[model samples]
Target: MTGTFKKIRRRVWLILNILVVFWMLAGVLCMQVPPSEFWPAGFVALSLPGALVLNFLFLLYWVFRRSWLLVLPLAALLLGWNYYGRLLAINFAEEVPKEAKTLQVLSFNTHVFNAYDKIVEGVPQVSNDMVDWVATHPADVFCLQEFYSRVNSIEYNNFNRIGTRYGKYKFVSTLETDRIKANLGIVIFSKYPILQGGTIHFLNKQRESANRAAWADLDVNGDTVRIYAVHLQSMSIKSEDIENTYSAIGNEESFKKEGRNVARRLKRGFIARAQQVEQLLEHVRQSPYPAIVCGDFNDIPFSYTYQELAEELENAFVKAGNGVGATYNGPLPFLRIDNQFYSPGLRAVSFETHYEMGLSDHFPISATYVLEPKAAE
Candidate 1:
């Protein structure tokens, strides 16, 4: 009887080990594949965090069991070091040099600065708080996504308020929607003079809301730096999806339906973002000056959108940030959809995500960079 029990335990362990290996392989494949509309790779990419955790658990299990299988998860982790680094970093007390010619940039998605809530509740407290925060947090440049402004509204003009807050700064924006009474778009406010700026409109199939990539050529002292502020295709996740995902355990049918809906949205977003990134990359390559890309990518670090962008630029978070560096404030807490990427000509000195501000669904990310004169030329 004891021998039979031991046999059953060994078989169970073997089965679990095989499952871990399969998941690890899937995670590795996700890292290698470029997510496209035709071949959607986000489902595999989404499995990565769980795979990593499972691998770590396996490593510990094998270690305690005194088994040679410990090497399997160890090897898997070593292979995906690049992906791990992007998810977390340990900078070891690195500090920015005081004398360096630095530029501070803040990227945020303000969820229309709570304008909807204000319109519904007859209270503008959240918008007022955000405006006050912007007035105090003195960044050299601000790349804002889901920005809202009104040209003819009787109550408030957020655009003018933000632009006029800093006496030395100039601002530019492009609407992502065609609302005549209000402007819903992305915006860039810079302390430096903007030489030229424009918007790249993306092709939307559903035509619900327009998404765009906006660029500005800023003369930063003696050097020209091109900045691209992009708001990619959103997943279109509704509150119902979140509730369904959480309550999915008991009812299989409802769970499956919600799962399908969520997956469909993710797949669509992944495809749309891929097309948008291709266009944005071409625009970046053609720029004569050093480029700094900042915005809410609406995708994860492990997705194809990030991989394509990372191939051309340095991720500021990986260069200078610490911890998981999550920027999204939602039901899915681990998502880091907001990012800052810079050309080789600039060195990211410090990168941070401000979580204290609760005005929006996205926590603001900021990075300070110094120009490398030789590389700039």
Candidate 2:
């Protein structure tokens, strides 16, 4: 009876171990395939980092047990070393060298600048704080997504406030604007002269939303650099969905129903983002100048959206970020969705995630990039 029980336990342990390895590999290799072609890979990607942690724990367990199973986890990690390699940063410099010819770029999603929120029901709301922050803070190029403005109001008129600070050259692409002249869009504000600018239109119509990506060609010290401010297809996780979460918990049927709704939104988001990334990647490849991509990707590093861009650009955080790259500040745990990526001609000297800002659901991120003389004119 003791021997039989030992056999049963061993079988369960082996099966669990194999499942972990399978999931780890799928998340690494399968993510390379477009989510449009196989949507399951997108779900696997969402679980990748967690699976990695589980695999590490499994390895430690095997080592302590003096079992041969340790080989599986070690081999899995080695196989996906490139993806894992990006998780850690060895760079220690937090600021760019004063001697370096640097372009300071800041990207943020302002969450509609909280224009809809009111303070005293009659006066201006907390958005004044964000407006004050932007007016005082300085950056050479500021790429803002979900940028909102009430064209008539003096208090929330960020369109003028931002330009008043530093940027005379600007480009604004509207995703939505209503009768009250309340504008919501993506914008590029540059201290440098904007030679040209335009919105990147994704071919897939299904992905259309208030989220959009825009770019600008700026004359930076006689060099033309393209800055892409992207707010890719939003996950659109609704407030009602969030409210239903607490009610769903502890009720098995309710939980499944709520889970399905959220899952559907995520799946839709994954496929749409993959489409957008493909289009943007082709545009980046054809760019005539060194390009810098910044904003809310709304997908993790393990995702197809990120993988597609990472293939063509150097991720700023992976290059110079100090630790824990998660930029989303909502209910989700450790989601590093906001990012900065640069063309080969440029390298990030320093990068920072502005987690201190609580004005929005997503944290703002900035990076100082220097054009490599040999790679860019």
Candidate 3:
């Protein structure tokens, strides 16, 4: 009986080990394949960090047992090593040299300035808090996503307040779905002069408020740095859908319906983001000056969208951030969805994720870049 129990346990471990390794490998390889080609790859990449944790546990178990199966998890990790920094980093913060040419850019999604949520007493109205914080921030350039404003009233004068509060600033914006003399959109404010700027109109906009990219070419002294502030396709998964992820007993049918609904949204987001990123990348390719891309990507670090961007530019967090550097604040935690990607010519001297500002569903991230001045042209 003891021998039979040992055999059953061994088989279970073996099966689990094999499954974990497969999932991890799938996530590693999926970054190169677009979800438009294989949609399931996006879902697989979503659980990659958790899958990595499980694989580590299995590795330890195998090592303690003096089993050769330790090779499974070990091989999977080595193969996925390229993505290690994207998911986790332990580098110390970098220091900006005094008098060095530096450009500070802050990117955030303000959740429409907490307009629809109840304002809690004494807990800091996130909308007011974010607005005030941004106004006083020292960043030379600000790229805001899901930016809200009331054009005709002083009630929601975020644009005028932030622009004037800081200093002399120029603005470029892409406002959509205006109603009641207000608008929801993306914008960029810069203390430096903007040489040129405009919006990248997405081909598909009606499905779930697919956002557009706002670009501004700012003249930092004599160098022109193009900044692209983008908010990609959202998964459209609501709070209730997250709550009903697992149906109650005797409501299996309802649960299944919700499951299908969530899956459909997820698949749609994956494909749409792939299409959007391709379009955004083409714009980057046409950029005559060095580019800085930042905003709420709405996709994970291991997705096709990030991979494509990383191939063209360096991720600021991976270059300078410490630990997980998670920016999303929501029920599903530990998601590093927001990012700052920049051209290789620029160095990320400092990177910070302002997780303490619990004002929005996503935390604000700022990065300071140092670049060599161009020769007198």
Candidate 4:
């Protein structure tokens, strides 16, 4: 009986080892591309775990076995290469800033009117808190997603109160939806003179949900700097999804339903986001000046949108930010979705994620960039 038990244990371990190996290979090879492609779909279909899970398992395996050989290779397969890439990007930013002109940009998703209702009831101080946050940051250029304001509001004067609070800044406000109750949209503010700026309405909504991308041309030392502020399709998994996910931990029916909903949302979100990213890619390709793309992407760092944007520009956070660099304003923030991506000629001098202000569901991200000089135009 003892011999039979030993054989059973050996068989179990062997099967588990094979499964782990297959999992690592699948994640590393075919599905390693940006989440905006076929790979993300494949991952979701397989019901494979996220990077966070794999990371945790990798560390736990080492803890139990005390073996560097197996653990180190797993780490490399999981997240090592991306981390190294981020390091190299930071090194590149550090060296380039010393020799060029600088531009500071801020990106934030105010979460539909400063997340006031989400956090508390009758929070009149929310607007003031937002103004104060911006004043403290003092960015050369600011891009705001979910920048809610009064309906039928026109011109930069509409935001005069907030503008005065931020040292009389100029801005271009786009109407995502013209409703007094919601009053939600995007606004781009600049201390630098705005040569030209406008809205790129992606989804014309009767109900007003999917509003994305704002464009601007700022005069940077007599050169044109194109800026694209974007907010992509959300993960679709809502508050109920979170509740169901937690409740399902012990309850079987709840668990099955929650799992199915999560899988459905993940697949749908990936496909829609990939389409949106492809459009943005086309926009970037057509841009006629040095570009800076900044906003609350709403997706994690590993998603397709982030990687696609990075192809044409350098991510400011990965370039200069340190630590986990999360920007979501919540009880336990574990991801960096707000980002600033700039042209290769631009260099990031300083980058920071402002987390102290409690006005929005997302914290603001700011970065100072240096524009390289040229002999010609």
Q: Rate the local accuracy (lDDT) of all candidates.
A: 0.80, 0.82, 0.83, 0.65
Winner on TM-score (2 vs 3): 2
Worst 10 residues of 4 by lDDT: 149-158
Check candidate 1 and list the clashing pairs: none
lDDT of 1 by residue, 1-377 (tens): 99999778867886787787787677667755756644456778767777777777877888998888778777877887777787778776556677667889989998988877765444332387886676568799988888877766544566667776465455556553434466778888888998889887776554533778889988988888998899998878966688878899689998888888888888888778877788789889999888999998998887778888998899999988899999888887778999999997898878889988977889999998998766434
- Model 3 Cα lDDT, one tens digit per residue, 185-223: 888999998888888876654443457899989989888
Runs in model 4 lying further than 4 Å from the true structure: 1-21, 28-68, 71-80, 83-99, 115-126, 151-158, 164-173, 176-183, 203-209, 375-377
TM-score of each: 0.90, 0.90, 0.89, 0.78
- Please say which candidate is ahead in lDDT: 1 or 3: 3
lDDT of 2 by residue, 29-131 (tens): 8779888889988998878887787877888887887888789888877777767656655678755566667798998888877766653645434377776
lDDT score at residue 24, model 2, on the 0-100 scale: 85
- As for model 1, its CA RMSD to the true structure in angstroms is 2.8
lDDT of 4: 0.65
Off by over 4 Å in 2: 1-14, 66-68, 85-90, 94-98, 119-126, 206-209, 375-377
Model 1 regions more than 4 Å off: 1-15, 31-34, 120-126, 153-155, 176-180, 205-209, 375-377
In candidate 4, which residue pairs clash? Answer: 36-304, 101-370, 101-371, 103-369
The positional error of residue 251 in candidate 2, measured at the CA in angstroms, is 1.3
User: Number of backbone collisions per candidate, in order?
Assistant: 0, 0, 0, 4
lDDT of 4 by residue, 1-377 (tens): 99999678756654565565565455444334545447354353233334335544655765676655455436545554663344223333355535467788888887654444533443222365675566566678878787765433332123554555565445555654422333456777777677777665554222333657878888876877888888877766666677768878988987988898887787766666666766777887887888888887766655555656766678888778776677876543466778888875677777887877656778888888877775585
Better of 3 and 4 by lDDT: 3
